[model samples]
Target: MSLFQNLKSELIRKPNSGKHLPFVDGLRFLAIVPVIFQHANERLFKYGNLPELKGWEEQVSFLISRGTIGVFIFFAISGFILSLPFSRENSKLNYKTYLKRRWQRIEPPFIFWMTCCALILLVMQAYPIGELLWHYLATVTYTHQLFYQEYSIINPVAWSLEVEIQFYLLAPFFAFAYFQVRSLAKRRSLLIAGIFGWILLQHGMGWHLQPWKATLLGQLPHFLVGVLAADLYQKPVKWIRDFRFWDLVFSLLLLTLAYTWTEELGKTFLFELSLLGLLLSAIYGRYTSRILSLSWISIIGGMCYTLYLMHLPLLEGYYSFIARFGQWSGYIGQLSISLIIVLPIIFLCSVIAFRWIEQPFMKKKDQKSLRSNPIGKQVLSKA
Candidate 1:
């Protein structure tokens, strides 16, 4: 198969698997693009600090400030996708297999990039070898988020990976508990209550926990919202699916409201709700936006994890090379130039990483191939 075809097959939901949802890939695209833009915006602001573009910088920053919301959307998507298997009737839990699959999917590219970033930082910053080793260990073990809250030692985005790992470990328990509740109404009610309780804990009660902002407790509501979304996906509500135009309208409205809320609590609540609305619209609402449903968009979304991991480092590298030319006059010129130079590089690198480093681990064990080569199969199976 051609590369595009391979990506499309890998990304699109298989028709036979009821859990496969193509629109969700599109949603992933939506989540990752903002993050890329946000990082790019930060780089542009850092390097293009021209006096002429001061007013434009503030305006652009405000617009892209919500890029972090994409992370919340990602958390919710994780909750939804991970919990989906359990939502089905008579789905058996295989803890060993689950962890193995997750490890294969998430770890290889992470380690590859983490090592690359660490090595680059070590040489560039000229840190002691021992200190660099410690930093590497902390980041690879996902401990950096707990001890080093200011900045990730290697890759800045790995902090979110730490949070994601926390969720991955607990997802089975969450799924089990979610299934124990017999009634759908009660399940939804409990989810809403959990979200409210989380809000109260984080905001009203002032209970700040370890790992600070990256703590699972602080982000639990978003994941719970995703769990709720998974339930909705399995047995979609007629009203929600039927409310096409209004669903889009309300989602956009919530997103707009999100801009006004500067506080973490308000921002989290509004953005999470907005994402939920958009997700529902993408899944159930009859009128799907052509932009989101496009094959190329979904393809990019499929490569999001790789894209997210690589974009920042690539941006920093690109900026270092381009900064010598000096800043462009206007915000548009700066943004356009940056995008033109940076985006293609990011996309190309992500695709290469996805194809080689990531995709190999995603492949299912080939029993036929294994049977043909007994000794090699034994080694592969053990691996």
Candidate 2:
């Protein structure tokens, strides 16, 4: 195939595939870009030697500080996607197969990039081999967040993945339980109760837990929001599905409230609600935002996992190189230079990683069946 055709194939979804949601991919892009902006802004402030912004610029900076919001959106997307399989009527879920697929989808790229980061640390003599070995072990096992107060020595982003893995372990049970409820109203009530309960627990009891926000308990509400969205998507109501301008209006209103809220619980709750509005608008609204649903945007969203994992390291490395080779300019000039040089590099690296490292390990139906029934299938074949 020609390059254009190949790119098209990758970007465009095959219609009626329940597994593929282009709008969700677009949502991923939205979530990840803010994260990139957050890191970029930090690097610019640290290394750019720019004069501090006094007025509007400072306000803009504060807005970008909301980059962690991307992580919340990601958790919601995870909940929605994972629960989707279980929410369908009469769906058969084999735990062994489900876990195997989850591992295959997540582990390979994570391990690959993590090992690369560790090797870089070794080469730079950043730590003793003995210490580095322990760090690597802790990181790969997703235990670094529990044991250490700081971000992972290998990759700070891995902290979120630890939370994600915890949810992965619990999601099957949650999905199964959700399906057992017969009445939709009761199900909605339970979801609402769970959301509020988690909020209360996080605010009330979380003080006793160090680094509470990073733990699964504190983040459970965000994932639960996604589960609710999944439920809506699976059995969509016409009122939600029919596109309306009010959906966007309500979403923006919630987002504004989230931004204004001083308390963590309030901010998180509002932000999650805003994300739900956006998700609903994208999925059901008659007039979906073209920017969000565009092919290129969705493709970027598809590569978000790889981009998120690698961007910080790449930023650090680029900053180090520029520091050695160049002199600092004003903020605008520095930011412009960094954007011109770094953004393309990040995009290129992300594309390569997505194509080779991440994509290869994604669960294909044939591979999944083989993995799930390896010995049984082999014996049958022999017979």
Candidate 3:
């Protein structure tokens, strides 16, 4: 490759490290970008001098807030990706290797960043070094919820990561019956029952905060939806085929319904159903799938773990630098500034982290690469 080609290749995305799926990474890109903006919008409001929303801007802000659905998107993707090995016939599941790979893939970047965060806080005297160290240890263990009964004092985002760990540990068993059973109707009926079963259990007993939202049980349906998507993607039904533009349009409608339900219909199994339809439509739609599978979009999606780990801290830490110019437009203007200015910085910094901190831990192949029953990823009230 020539010089420009070399740099471009390196900059665009890393190498394949496993069984690759281009559109899924594209799906991740679609999911994560909104999450970055969601935080940027929140920061511009809470910490910046942006003027109040006028007219339809309030509606826009409401839409932006819903971007945290990226968290659940990640959950679904994790379910889809991790379930892949088991979803294949005659595929053997090795318990130890599966456990080890999950640890190796995500743990280092998380630990490095959290350590950096803890050291930064200690150096700044935000907390006593001893106390900070104690919290740091708790955060890495994915037990900060139990230790603090709150979001990690170290890194708030680590909460969802804990649920990722839980899902990682549990995914094999969840995926087994779905793929193992030869009878589609029998397996799918059971899957549907399991999803609503969790919902009904929550509805009947009432939900609790503290540790409950931080665990995998809180968001199990979304992950199950991903598993369902994997099943359908692998063994698609007779009528379930591509419709190109129509499929994309249908996905948009499903997304809109899913978005509006963010508040009132938030915890129901119905929400996961919408997400399922969205995933299937996006995948089976020929044009939508092609667009999602494009080199650039999928590559960015491929690096989402680094983005998720770093974006919030970067926004929170650096907002003051940009907040000075926050009064320019209304909410739209502040948001525009973030999209134009802040997002690039987040990406640039994250690319470095992806190249060094994350890629080193990736499988030898450099390819690409949530919560509820997991942490909801609502911006933390405090450390």
Candidate 4:
């Protein structure tokens, strides 16, 4: 009993008592900034017409392309975090309750943000009101990804949300499957096989799926890696800590190979390795590192969702303005100046959105849900 108490104390030192994991938040920051940089790079390159300017365009393009790895990180993190709430109890989680919570958590922010985007587009006369209304409703339903035509009309980042929604829908089934497997090794084997089958299916069906759509299923491996990592966290695997350096090294090598190969399969393969390494590294590092544990990153990390949703609009406007009146001495100059002004404004907007929009709605929903549960009261009484 004393040994167990000591072990618990050693592991319980995470800031905020593990309610929020800083390394995961740091991963969020990593995912979001690269995505933003990628979008910004896309805009700059298109506007610059590939003119050389201190080689900034090339650098931005490289970083932006790599940002797709950020999506993998997001998926892995989601897989782990979403499973956390269910880990403590042996009570067969009420699927209805699970679905309801998922819906409430994701829908409000998504609907609100998409509506604002649609309204902006309407006011700008970007599309007809009749078509806008149709697309708007479709996006709200999270069915926009099903129809190829519907996708072009809405926020493009939502393509990932579409896949994420599918994962959420299946989480209950996944949890049930995990619980049914009495042996840890068997469960891990099943997950690995499932991921491999998904990849092969994507490859086999690539001819039928539009290239982008084909690439969409490629994200499943990363999500599975997250689930595996979560399982590892619940049951400590001593080898994970010992293998940290190798994991990091191999992950980097695979990523480099993927970029050099530049194939769809290459991207998918590297993403999985990078994500698994990232999780292991975070765990081994004690969730604190000079590179990722800084205050600014943690703060920005909190606002990642807002930043992701709003960046396209901000970048579009910024790009339009720059093209109209600005030309840099070279590509580098243009990119530097553009990023200098736009990044801070985007950051500021993300903070405001988090405070005024996301936080308020999240607080209301959580409070209402907590009031409705009252399970804590029962637990406390027993204690």
Candidate 5:
């Protein structure tokens, strides 16, 4: 069979959207795998280990820069997913339930992971219990970035978690802003104009730390694209479903040219636009013919959150322990061995955490409250 035929067959195998969107789960698979590869062997790719004209020792200088694109993909995916439920027919989507659901979904696993990290440090006598607890508090509250340069923050992967939490907190306000504009056509036009304007504004302003901080003009467009994708999904524009591959191919070529020039900001813009097109293509099932849908990849994608949270610290610990071997073959051998050891460990840890910890807390209906002064349902319901 042709590759497209194989891809179509695999996509058809997935259960339809009584659950989540299958193609999106597949998209998550794509995003998370790149992240893992980037984290694990980005150094190798940097030094030109993979197939190319360059020698291994003279690896490209800008390979780590691709990690920024991975992060943008993540932000865009999130903005789309988070906006999905709110854009539907249910005008009175209860904010309290939304908040509670988000809390239950996020807090338990995070707290568990942070506490586990603290306990490990304490037992190793690397830190006093008091200092560990403070670190734990900062991480649990998603303020780790604010204290990152100072405290013994456990999971640096969590910088994105801080962003995700901020998105969640501001979701209601964002929704309010969207709905306040009564005209749908005008709202969409405004969104289109805003997307272009934000990119230009960032370019005009240059790459100062201040725009990065505001994130409104910098990261907001990616997030807004995702939000707009969600809106489009609920009430799709028919022509979007007919989006031609040649258009995306042209976009991809433009993206490659930008990357080749080492234009970081231009790459971000091109990459985000390409990702947006791909996401729309996936949603409309236009590119269903191109998916591999590997069972192993889907399984790992399911555990991506856990792997994302744990991989860095786990890899660091592994690196420290491996340095004792002293006389290693080379970077390739070291990276391959490290990946072989780490992938299985990351998978196992994520599966166990998802089953034993994350699942119960994220039940559709809230269960019995665990705390004496649980953040009351009323506030949570507004979420």
Candidate 6:
């Protein structure tokens, strides 16, 4: 291969979402996989021709649906990733530039996918343009939940992105409060409180409430946990040590639990604590960290945004197309078949978006510290 092609080929595996760093990308990988599973699992019952499940099948289906813990993981990862810049010593945020850069990096691909998905829907489903247009506008503005108190009409998964954007706008302020206290004990104590505080409030106020569940207040605990992780990640973290197999086991156990959990808005105190352990293992566990840091794995994890944004739309197309072939019965066969068919398509499309679309934004140098960078002011100099 030519040198330019070689460079691009290698770079394509490096996800630019949060520094193209293995540790964060690995976590991203962890976060995105379950989300895909959550959706796939949900779709199996819908498109899989299975009757309302009974016995263990019904119970298992409900538990498998808990793959949404990945979304909460993403929230924590965002908190951890964004905290790097603002959490650095003597840090001061350039509010306007920060917001601008965030938009520039994230908005184009988001808009592209949204527009494409909307157009495809219009053409295929033949929804009235007036209704679709209004929903499209609302989705674009991230205000769909407020109007409809539900997932985006254009992109069902965009509800999480809406929550993400809410966190993004407020992250710096949260950081300000976090970093203000000079005492480490006091600062960490504050984070712990914030974490539980939000969880308690959500559960206390009833997370089942429609519009409120869609907001940041519902997910703030997860973000706070991420902030706590950032603080630990920036140093050797005196308290954190690889417990060899135990730490690895700890991570796996929590992951299994997260996959099976069916409960609150996914920002509970135990969940937040579990995120810290889960992420810390990925960051610090000798065995766990090595596996997570594998080049290919982290590379795929980095492209999670594309996978996330495009998965549902792609699935819509896939199921429709596959319906022509035949339908599969039994949840087991359906799950396996859907994943085998759908995952490859999602990855292929994500690679294209990552290399051509997202990477260009990363090339626009900013004063942001990367997770891949050694905990400091190491700017990503675009080649």
Best by TM-score: 2
Deviation in angstroms for 278 in model 5? 2.8
Highest-scoring model, lDDT: 2
lDDT of 1 by residue, 1-383 (tens): 99868766765433222233557777788889988988888887677655555776777667786688788778888888778767776555556556665676678888989999999988897578888888888898888866666457688888888888898889877886797787988888888888877876777644334446676766777788888888898877778767748545745744663483344666656665766776676676554645566788777887788888899999988877777777555676777777988889899888878878866765555445434432222212211
TM-score each candidate.
0.87, 0.88, 0.88, 0.82, 0.75, 0.87
Can you write out model 2's per-residue Cα lDDT over 220-325, one digit (the tens) per residue? Answer: 8778988898888888877777656744574574356338434566665666567777667767755465656778887888878899989999998887667664
Clashing pairs in 2: 243-285, 243-286
lDDT of 6 by residue, 262-364 (tens): 4454534456667788877887777777787787677778778878888887776777666555555666676677789888888888888777876676554
Off by over 4 Å in 3: 2-4, 11-18, 208-211, 242-246, 250-254, 257-267, 324-328, 365-383
Q: Positional deviation of 138 in candidate 1, in angstroms? A: 0.7
lDDT of 5 by residue, 222-274 (tens): 67788777777777777776666633453364345336323366655665566
* Model 4 RMSD vs true structure: 7.3
In model 4, which residue pairs have backbone atoms overlapping below 3 Å? Answer: 53-331, 53-332
Which segments of candidate 4 are over 4 A away from where they belong? 1-18, 48-60, 87-91, 207-218, 244-267, 286-291, 364-383
lDDT of each: 0.72, 0.74, 0.71, 0.64, 0.59, 0.72
**How displaced is residue 225 in candidate 3, in Å?**
0.5
> Which residue pairs clash within candidate 1?
none
**Residue-level lDDT for 84 in candidate 4:** 45
Better of 4 and 6 by lDDT: 6
Residue 287 of model 4 has an lDDT of 33
Q: What shift in Å separates residue 19 of candidate 4 from its native position after superposition?
A: 1.3
Of the two candidates 1 and 5, the one with more favorable TM-score, higher being better, is 1
Candidate 4's C-alpha lDDT?
A: 0.64
